[model samples]
Target: MTKVRTINNYTGIDTRSAIGTVDHPLANMDHAPTISELCKVFLKDGVALAVNASRKALHEAQLSPLDITHVVSTTCTNSANPGFDHFVCKELGITQPVEKVLLHGIGCSGGLASLRTAANLALGSSFRKRRARALVIALEISSLLVRSELDSINDSQDTRIGVTLFSDCASAAILCNGFGGVEAEPVYELLGWDNRVIADTEHDLGFDVDPLGWKVVLSPRVPKLTSAAVSPTFNKLLQSLPKLPPHYKTASDFDWALHPGGATILSGVEKAMNITPEHMRASYDTYINHGNSSSATIFSVMDRLRQKDMDKLAPDGKAKDFVVGCAFGPGIVIEMCMLKRNMSHIQRTLVVESGEATPSHTESERSEGEAGQEIEIQIEMGSMEGKDEELGEKLRDMHPEVPQQGDSLSEALNGVELD
Candidate 1:
């Protein structure tokens, strides 16, 4: 039998740029009260960003809480007993079944792993037995794991690459057996999945669970490893297919939705798979603005594509085929999915605003940061749905001791107790 589809997705980001940064470090932390306080500042930010994303999906798709059947949450950053999966159910007023999966110590690629799991569940389960719907949320707080004291950040060598390159983010995606209210035309069919774990690379990229939090020890050889495996795996995937599309030249030929592992990782993949500049820009820009929010990073890029008005950009009805998404993790494994783009008017304009107005962030709040220190966080929340002060109040009330204006959000979050 044909399986259900992943219909809609939403992304979110929380960083100094979006939320006011403070010198204390803890100020910019995620405001949700359930998680450990020892978490890296970025984790909280990432979750907040992800929350907005889930909200956006519910609002934009006009999906009611009762319509949702399952909630699958993915994260490698932080996990509390009553995790965000439950928070999502509670906050969204979704009384449906919620399953929270912490892909802890797994690394960045876990998002795809979770997606595959969700897809399989939807495919395997009996839709007739019960309404089958699943929502997957991937939130990465890489910022929380950065060790400023580590030689990587302290030393100017390749070690510092990890701390400086990683940012914080969160993303929420909804997958269901039916499209609910919208026309029944499915977006992406559930094609077969192919995943491979490179052997003996466990030490290459893993986390150190210490008193501070999850510290990433990513090997410099990561990009090379990624470059080495991508082509063969891709070719092997193509071989399995009965007929290959002539349009497929390289990994870049299709729309690339790869995890923004880092700028260098992207460059390596670009060289390895012949990815074009346009294809890589989304990943790179997401990393630059929001850093790496783990699973959420890819969705952020997708959301940007959605926001860029791809339809207006390609109005000739020349739809793209075989969109590929890849994510990497601890096993030095690559998880990839191939899907076809659905450029139907409803899908295209579903999230697009009626007016062609350029979205704006209120510039009047620029003075919120400290003197002489420029904030480097990405405020990729797109157009403001509510006032920054409203979010600021929520944050301040969550952490009353932290001053609103400071060097960075991390500094403010320094004092919060995760235990």
Candidate 2:
């Protein structure tokens, strides 16, 4: 479980420098391409960006295209026919029969969802035979969705607020299990992941697709609804960890990559999760500089974390350092994951001295069986029924065209297989 590693990560640059101008990360698309034009430009440019980003990641990790066994990508911007995933594989010159998963519909949460799905693939037996290496990509072209027209005061407000923070972005990460990392730098291992759907919030966020293009929906009540739903779910996830004591929190060592859906959304998550603003500096910085490029935003934030030096996540006595990723999207979905950094030489020495295989969660304690800690999360959600033209188009729900690679930790630990 500890071997799963983020070998390298990269973010795409907007070819259309005019997109993110002085004020907004994504300038108004009033003079931008039409739906058909945007689709063509976006896919072409997005694919190139993704491929180059992947190349950069592989280069930095000193890996080759032959090292990658699978390709996974997620996006809500535009759904293509062959899917740009094929392009990624083709560009990387990966001729082997690599597994591929291209997810759509899910918005901001799709990044973490993609990583989680890749983690499952890495852990599964089918893909774990020799080694597991997967590339995860997220791209968003909000400028294409930017609109000057509005149908209602709601639409006007949404576009106005949306344009202020939305941008064009693409990010790629290489994840491998066991033999993933050879460098001594700190490693981010996927520990666990959980997701929750806030009932009745479909309209809170989504793309209103038509023959013209897509329009973003930004409900004003998002903060209240999101906070109410996220509070308990966040708590529920913490309590689900194995070694973690139920209802125990002291000094926080978790490096959070909370999706910056917006400024208010950040505050809402903090209020709901009881994490201070300091924990979300990465998210805020991304928002201010890159805007909410949908699913790709989290990676930019993680890049900031990496730049600031991730060694802090290494163990320091009882001060545990962790990486937590969170994102919310259409369907009122909340995706989250907890990742622990690979032990540095010092940390390995300390753990060996303590005779523990993993970090201990002895900072706090709670009752073993404290009745039921269930807390219902409520929010206004509504699926866009008629807007099916977007997702329901050529790419419907298509599961990965491969068998399971490995099992979850509960089913069978990949410890031996990975090592």
Candidate 3:
């Protein structure tokens, strides 16, 4: 029998403070700083974020420093000597000789690309006996490099959209062969991973790095080109999957966890994929609140889904086949992952492997609603500050198990309980 693999745990950090944003002290600065200055801010924020997220992941997963054998550090916004990987290990007191992989140069999609690479390493590497684990972190401090309005010399309005749409954040995901006792959902086997280059679109997006830091090169045409390519590329991905639902519409068929590349890109993708605008509210929420945290943006969406699922488990649940994630990287590539919700699976509510009981779920009941009303509402409770604990508790109280949460799909799955 083939062994199964699952993500043991996930942890994240938002590092927007060390940079200049609308709220940062330097936000009102007159000119874009030199590349070196950009580097300084980026490195500082990146290192701090990497360290924090690493600690959180290990703590939540309840894994010691030595438990991690490989480290994959991903960032498109920053790089340095004793790079993020080294800095993170050092800061976290992780003595394990972490093999490093820096995923820079690629744009937003790089996060998923890193995920694919890390997954391959976990599945194919000879680490099973050693119980070696791979930790992948996607960190982006986009706001740091954003151009200032006062500094705008001869730039077009479209040029600023990139900076406006991006926010800062870091997300850590782990792929373990078999950690002694890590509880997670079923092994969502890695289907086929593929990539394609949109010829002539290279001019659409990239960075010009020098002494002045990364000067973003974003084209207004990005949305149009992306919209054109989505249909074909998504179709190719579906054909590669061994099993696809008959009800599948197109690549844009389900609820999406997309990189908040910007409102424009999101609009383009929805049109290209033929998905309803409402299907992408999660992505929009991330954009509005977090901006564009590069590779880590998708995780924000995943975190939302995880929280929602945990908060809404029905006493008698149904299945979920409604979520998918995608991002855009270098070569203007799109990285995609599909999630299928299974109700029978048993999963913990909010306690991470780090053993911090953020929240725990119990059974709860609500009255059946009238027709045309969507009872299941996934709110980003903690996206704002000072509400993490309360939001977590809310999730646990409502969704305790997969089966019960799944019951939201059917009227017959309800039980009686008064408020």
Candidate 4:
């Protein structure tokens, strides 16, 4: 049943390299991959990435084997019977009697959607029971399906542009009522959740089944449309908040966890919210380094951003920083969450029940040393008046180790002059 022959982490990003790779068998043949091949790629990419991510989360949470009570997964790439959850359970060795839910066709918005579901299911408890935990994971392997058979201009710049925006990645999180460690970092408190499907724009974005494989139904009007509409939707979410934090009147108050769907998408959301690179640095970095990894992209974004302006619980059981996580998908849907930095896991857990926990995901690790090395550059807002290349160049000079846009695996490494 093992479809993967090997693992070669060709992509520059180390985290994504852990996931397996796929090949377009028909690229050179100028034909479609047999449906069997497509299915095989889908299963392999989804299952492998899911298992790797789950294992990482388990290790980080220090969870014992067979301890997870439920597994929630989302994917729009490929699917089959016995599904990804079944594979994850067997591979991760979760005990029987575990609940399973698979969300399909949700597209990029599915990650936060799955997180919202997990949080709702795990509500009402501030302490973990042996059987009361949920693991949420998202896999988007759309990069594996690029075949010239489907595009009118094979390997053309525009056709290949999608690969630069969509990538293959998987990310997971362990949601419990509470964790024992207040100092154990990287636990994201589920503060608030919101979602909306934009009316009359259903066809604007979607995935459609086609002969070659899944056809991407993306419209060029996406950036402008989303820019104009998303802010209102975000405002609606804030209005639905049970209780607003002090002086938190606009989107500027919360750091954004945008999907990094594309450069335009990221910039569009940034412009609409009146935020800047510092506010959405993770989103920009994810796009430049990881491409748009669909639903899994935000997990990477949050992970990279774990320690930025974060802190532990105050004596009063609230956090200083807050974040709003969001993703857009085919239904023209917007998946959103309001997260705050937690001072203590158990303390915040109690506050969550009382609707007063404000927190962010602060990974329990030394904030200094290696963790601080990857910190983002702090630039003043509206300082980005240069062209795209100029901005990219400035970012590159700040971190010369970061590979440039046209960097191939070898080229990216070529600049790594050894000591």
Candidate lDDT values, in order: 0.51, 0.56, 0.53, 0.57
TM-score of 2: 0.68
Off by over 4 Å in 4: 1-30, 124-131, 148-151, 155-161, 179-186, 242-244, 307-320, 343-419
Measured with C-alpha atoms, the lDDT of residue 82 in candidate 1 is: 63
Instruction: Report the candidate with higher lDDT, 3 versus 4.
Output: 4
Is 3 or 4 the stronger prediction by TM-score? Answer: 4
Find the number of clashing residue pairs for candidate 2.
14
lDDT tens digits, residue span 344-363, model 2: 42211112224211222222
Q: For model 3, how does the per-residue alpha-carbon lDDT over 290-346 read when each residue is reduced to its tens digit?
A: 656777777666555444332233212322355666777656676776555333433
Which scores greater on TM-score, model 2 or model 3?
Answer: 3
List the candidates' TM-scores in order: 0.69, 0.68, 0.70, 0.71
In model 4, what lDDT does residue 412 have?
21
Q: Write the per-residue lDDT of candidate 1 for residues 1-419, one digit (tens) a residue.
A: 00000000001122222333333354333331212564433344445566666655544434555555566677666666666566656755666455445455566776677777776665544333333456667766654443332423344433223443455556666665432223123344444456788888777776666455556655656667876778877777666654547777566567666777654466567788875435544454465446566666666765554333332222132325556777777777888766554444133122435522122211111112111111000112242222323333332232123233333332212211010
Ranking by lDDT: 4, 2, 3, 1
Worst 10 residues of 2 by lDDT: 374-383
